[model samples]
Target chain A: MAPKLGIVAGSGGLPAKLAEKCRETGRPYFVLAIEGEADPATVAGAPHAWVRLGAAGTGIKLLKEQGVVELIMAGALKRPSLASLRPDWRAAKLYAKVGLRALGDDGLLSAVIKELESEGFTLVGVDSVLTDAVATEGCYGRHRPDAQAEVDIAHGFRVVDALGVLDIGQSAVVQQGVVLGVEAIEGTDALMRRCGTLRREGPGGVLVKAKKPQQERRADLPTIGPQTVDLAHQAGLRGIAIEAGGSLVIDRDEVAARADRLGLFVIGCRKPS
Target chain B: MAPKLGIVAGSGGLPAKLAEKCRETGRPYFVLAIEGEADPATVAGAPHAWVRLGAAGTGIKLLKEQGVVELIMAGALKRPSLASLRPDWRAAKLYAKVGLRALGDDGLLSAVIKELESEGFTLVGVDSVLTDAVATEGCYGRHRPDAQAEVDIAHGFRVVDALGVLDIGQSAVVQQGVVLGVEAIEGTDALMRRCGTLRREGPGGVLVKAKKPQQERRADLPTIGPQTVDLAHQAGLRGIAIEAGGSLVIDRDEVAARADRLGLFVIGCRKPS
Candidate 1:
């Protein structure tokens, strides 16, 4: 029999979807739902352990007890400060050893992944489980990016690349040959809402997301879904462009159908270099 | 005597200050007050004519009639869409000739400058008109950036430098090793307001403004003033940094006093090579 798989759940439906997949495949899986982050409903019928984000060694102990030899971290967690984190003793010890001067989000995540790996649990990537979650190149649905949108999408990619080098956020919105906004700590939702007010009078903006150059590839990739399409539509955007092979699309069919219904284009473009 | 000075006044106190300076220096000057932009009080008691932003040939005619030879564009003008701009025949002609693909703010400004230059007018930078307006190195008031703030400030500069090559906006805020936000077409005030909601738990972010690499030097410069300080304070920012010699600091004394009262720092630093 395969080793028991552990899902470290945070916010959003990705974790729930992963759990449902395991149930359908008849694989034994356990969830470690993070308090104040993961939805309780996601863990309602699954064998799970509840813990705060700051539970370091204790969290590992719970997984070990459940015979979880393989782990998959899914969903989103906001970057919290050390004070807000309220890390336990083991967590505090790990942070001390990170020795990061410019403490980036990716750096903290890398440290966490290292600690998990040292405990003898193999980190299974999302692609290894949910095969279709990975984005691929080409137009997604009924609509397509016009010539104007292509220009804006190109600009957005350039902005993301420059920002990625500095460990900044991964998304940017460009419209009618002008940058509307770039995502930072505020995340993609806020970026869209803010850009809504800043939209120009021509064709609408395109939202582009890429993997931050400094991101831990095994831990996370940029993600988009039905909510992303909804946000883009509400923000008066004409389309969405995510980096193919470097981003995850939750429920591709649902995302495409939503984009079609809302009169928007959703495409996965190859990152320029 | 200096050439007959023509002040193309937009929004804010900078235009009024410039007009007052001309009065104090006894330089013959005419103010081209932009309707719906320049405060009426600013052009009061000054030789002036009102014009819409789209007034091109007629505006130049008015300036020439006033015997004005040197033009100083002052204050802020929000970027306008061509549809809303209602461009006159001459203005439309210039826009058509520019042929910009990814039409950045700087590219449009450069085109405008060339049009005026070809019309036999000399465009002077803000530094030349208001000698004290240009930013200088060092802290302006009571606060110096702490070690953390300094790191953020450095990060902010890097963000601006990266954004500059693409002709994006010149200001960004960083705190606790994270980029809070970047200025785009929405301008600095909106950037501050949005970032206020995104501020982290530790020390406040620092606002950094630099000249976009492709900006038109003889026409405009990145600017800050007492109002900039107020915005930063309201946004929970701790300090302000501007590129020395490349950014304008309106009413420097008043700005320092306001920053000090608000418990914020305002400094100017050299742009990193």
Candidate 2:
């Protein structure tokens, strides 16, 4: 008999990989994968149940029924369609506890964590199982930012860090010496689109993304992947820098290959001076 | 004939009023208004010239031709259009002279001011004309934020000020304890739309718009009014706070009346605790 862990899975391959890692480590895990967000293959080797993100409370109930002790949350939850999230009685109660006109990504996650902890389900970090996934410091790929792009990267990193410190946002767009855009709840993708729509040479800026300095662990972390790289290439961005070890690098090889082909510099950046 | 001052105008009626005050105080002023931003009437009384925002050289030339001794930059410039600004030789030269990539707003403006002074225009502050137009400390409307909203406002003010210090932005969208959006080049109106689109309910949230603590006084001063109030109502924001004396209050009658009708509190927010 192996130690049983509970997995709250979101969309993407990360959930599947996490489940595989648990099995390989001789830990039997019960996965509650979000419908549409999680890969269909997430539960093939693991005892798993399908759950919609809107029904997260129900997932917790299922995990509890499986006699799981520690819960590991992994992957990305599709942002809930506010109009469609039909909260069950348990979810409704959780909602009542979060009193506000709106909840930011961090606020909502913290509230959810509190609710789970109060219920006797111990929460664990998403990366606790896969430590090697965090990108190393310095440039990750073969291509590096050009002299001008490097300057923009430095500028973008500082602006993004400033936004993070204010707990407002953690992404910024910079070109030459001017900022093209800053990310808010609309996310990095939208910010790229706006920069493209607003500027003619569109993808000529640099995009920097990072986690807020004071963000609670075991919650939302900055993430990037092939799509992000593709979007940057499409938006005419010259380069991108993500904080080393603090962000999820999904399909790093594919992202790097895309960057190489597009002549865009994609690297794990350090703290800008 | 009165001594002429140069009124560098951007958006809204603040430029108009600044010009009116200069006239009332017996000074003939040359108004240099950004074509798409200024109220035509604000410059109608003065010897005014229209210049596109990115054309710093044209702005300088206009003031110089009018024999203007003192320059007063009032109102807000649309964040320079990254996609469409067509700069002349002077603006190109000015851009070259000020080449730091991540320089904050004050840094950029100081560069612009230094260039203008080098060319001999004396930049002045709006307080020299109508001191009453400067906001004072206190809640300006009928509704004071309830305890929760007050906490939100205080937190939001701190966040906005931190952002100001880094020159990332100056406004934030706060609801309860969460920040939904922070103003960048897109400005407050766009941030309001992002909040409204993301979380479509509640009596409304709090919007804190402040001037950067170390901003160049003669440059654009943050201003709010009826349109802002209307935007708040449409976006479901409960209130707004502008910095006292550090901002401009334009079209007060309409703004206050609209706010009262909408049950939205429009306050003159001070520096945070």
Candidate 1: the clashing residue pairs are none
- Give the chain A TM-score for each candidate: 0.96, 0.83
The deviation in Å at residue B235 for candidate 1 is 2.0
lDDT of 1 by residue, B154-267 (tens): 888888988888887899988777788888877888899988988867678899999987677765588898999999999999999999988999988989999989999999
Q: What is the lDDT of residue B111 in candidate 2?
A: 85
**Lowest summed lDDT over 10 consecutive residues: which window, candidate 2 chain A?**
A194-203
Question: Which whole-number lDDT from 0 to 100 does residue B112 have in model 2?
Answer: 79
Q: Write the per-residue lDDT of candidate 2 for residues B1-273, one digit (tens) a residue.
A: 645788888776678787777767777777888888888888775788888877877788778888888877777665553346676888877766776445556787878788888887777777666677677777766777887678778878887887777676778877766676777666778778878875534445688888887888777667787888888888888888888878877767777788888898888866744
Model 1 spans > 4 angstroms off: none
Instruction: Point out the worst 10-residue segment of candidate 1 chain A by lDDT.
Output: A99-108
Q: What is the DockQ (computed on Cα atoms) for candidate 2?
A: 0.28
Angstrom error of the Cα, residue A106, model 1: value is 1.9
Candidate 1 falls in which docking quality class? medium
lDDT of 2 by residue, A1-273 (tens): 645788888766677777777878888788887787777777776788887667766877898899888887776554453435677777777777885334556676788888888888888876676676665676656778777677778777777777776556678887655676787656778888777654434237788888888776686577777888888877878778898877777777787788888887778866644
TM-scores for every candidate against the unseen true structure: 0.94, 0.85
| lDDT tens digits, residue span A1-273, model 1 | 667899999888888888998999898999999988899999999999899888887898999999999999887766665666788898989988995346777788888888899999998877778888999999889899999899989989989988887777889999878888887778888899988888867678899999987677766678899999999999999999999998899989999999999999999998766
